[model samples]
Target: MTADARDLARWSETLAGIARTGMAFTESLYERERYEEVLHVAGDIKAAARAAADEVEVEREVDHFVQEWMESIGEGVPGYVTPKVAIGAIVGNENSEILLVQRKDSGIWLYPTGWADIGYSPSEVAVKEVSEETGIECDVSRLLGVVDGQRMGFSRFGMYMLLFHCTATGGELNPHPLETGDVGWFSRDELPEATAGAAWWGSMAFAAIDGEQAPATFDPVRDAIWRTDDT
Candidate 1:
């Protein structure tokens, strides 16, 4: 998708999040009305973005976005809007091959990843996700990268992907019966054509796998925080 469409969607989501957070805390009727207005405007922007991206009139109404955001509102800290967290593992075997899985829903190949569970530490989530998705018993070596899922086009909603490098201690290539369609160990040069986001993450993953002593990577602050292509 073009940067404009993505930027519009991002902006709309940001506005909706802010408004929802405000609504969660404010007690004044006037303030709630103001927040609702903001939500309405945000819905319009998101709908326009969808239409622009698809190059067709969207049947979904702007109220769809508003209603979804409204349903997510809570009364206290739970209502504080923030990006959702997901954990990803780049597990490498003794052969220096990377472990990847084909997502059942999208058929796109990526490292084993899942939503961060509430009770587990981030690294624990990484280990658990790998085992659950690919039947790989892995130990986290280090943090590999922290990436924005929306900015990377991996998701439409706000999310932070915590990527970890891991060593595949044991397990066969047993794909999860539900989550993954296939699983395999692939050399860096032979990554499947359908592998997702390899351009940005592939080199960093391989570097960590190769025993590089480097700091964990993250998205740098943009000069214009709201701009689409600032990098």
Candidate 2:
């Protein structure tokens, strides 16, 4: 979208207000229908702003504003907010065994990943998430790509995923009960059934194994990429 900075800021503020109100209702004893109505309005406002801006980045910024507002109110609300950031890794050894984890929530396999936190860069978030979820200390080698994952069901609000090719520098595999249920290494041909919403890995696997860098952003909702070749 080509909106001026001031206009984008205005729309972002409005969307944030809507999110705050919805969060407040969720915190209270509001009925499910009422809560859903509020969320729908928030989504509509976001859609309108995005339509005006005609830019994926603009829509993502607005979505982040809404998520920040919801997080500020607290986390009692169910499915009201999306993860701000996430780190996915391609961890392997000389034997080429890729690391995978089973999430406690869905019992599905996935790479070590988690949401971004305040004061952390995307790369930092990725490293921290990998360590926190799987206890494998990794150093990020390169940024493979950033892809929009809203359609993958991986995000509740809206999310941009940063996938990294990383090396396991040290540390043994230790699972965290609060985040992961199991951890292990597997070959590419022996990949496990990933939990729903972990679609980022499938794309990353194709990129890493083929030695290709998908250095463009994807809009999952539209099934289009912001091609580098495009002006």
Candidate 3:
């Protein structure tokens, strides 16, 4: 997709997220009705953004997503909407192998990751995720990177991922019972099939794993943070 189209889609998703979050937290019927209208507008924007590529099924998919989003609303506390935070770990062993797991739901390979919990710090969550998902004990060494998950097409709602570099401390290899289908360690050149966004972070992750002075990565400042146009 063109950059402009991608920008439009992201905005649509952001607007939809705001509307849903509002619907969840607000008890006022009038406010909810307004939020519902925002949802409808978001759905239209999403469908139009997708339909730009001449896809016929775009409308159905967009409508279905909106309907599901509306149905999923529950009583939520009132606050400004924000992205959900997730933690991920890049665990590298002495053998220069990085740990990975295949998600049961998506069947795609990614580093150990999980939603942030209330009591855990970001690095604590990262360590916990690695152990829980891959049966690999790791010590959180340093933060590797932070990423906007929605912009990466990895989430339906807004999310930000905090990735950490970790050292394999101890543990036998075993996949999580319900979350993973398989888990393994791989070298830099031997990443598994169906890996998500490996091209972007693979080198940095490997560098950090290798004890190199790897700088953390984040999205660069865009000319118009919200717009895709060059000028």
Top model by TM-score, which number? 1
Clashes of 3: 0
lDDT (Cα, tens digit) per residue for candidate 3, span 74-153: 66764455788999898999999999999999899999989999999999999888888988898988888899876776
lDDT of 1: 0.90
Residues 46-70, candidate 1, lDDT per residue (tens digit)? Answer: 8888898885465566878899999
Best by lDDT: 1
Q: Which RMSD does model 2 reach against the true structure?
A: 11.2
Q: Write one digit per residue (lDDT tens) for candidate 2, span 177-199.
A: 78788998877677776644435
Against the true structure, what is each candidate's TM-score?
Answer: 0.96, 0.58, 0.83
Provide the clash count, candidate 2. 4
How far off is residue 89 in model 2, in Å?
A: 2.2
User: Measured by TM-score, how close is model 2 to the native structure?
Assistant: 0.58
Candidate 1 RMSD to the correct structure: 1.6
Decreasing TM-score order of the candidates: 1, 3, 2
For candidate 3, what is the lDDT?
0.84
The stretch of ten residues in a row with the least summed lDDT in candidate 2 is 222-231
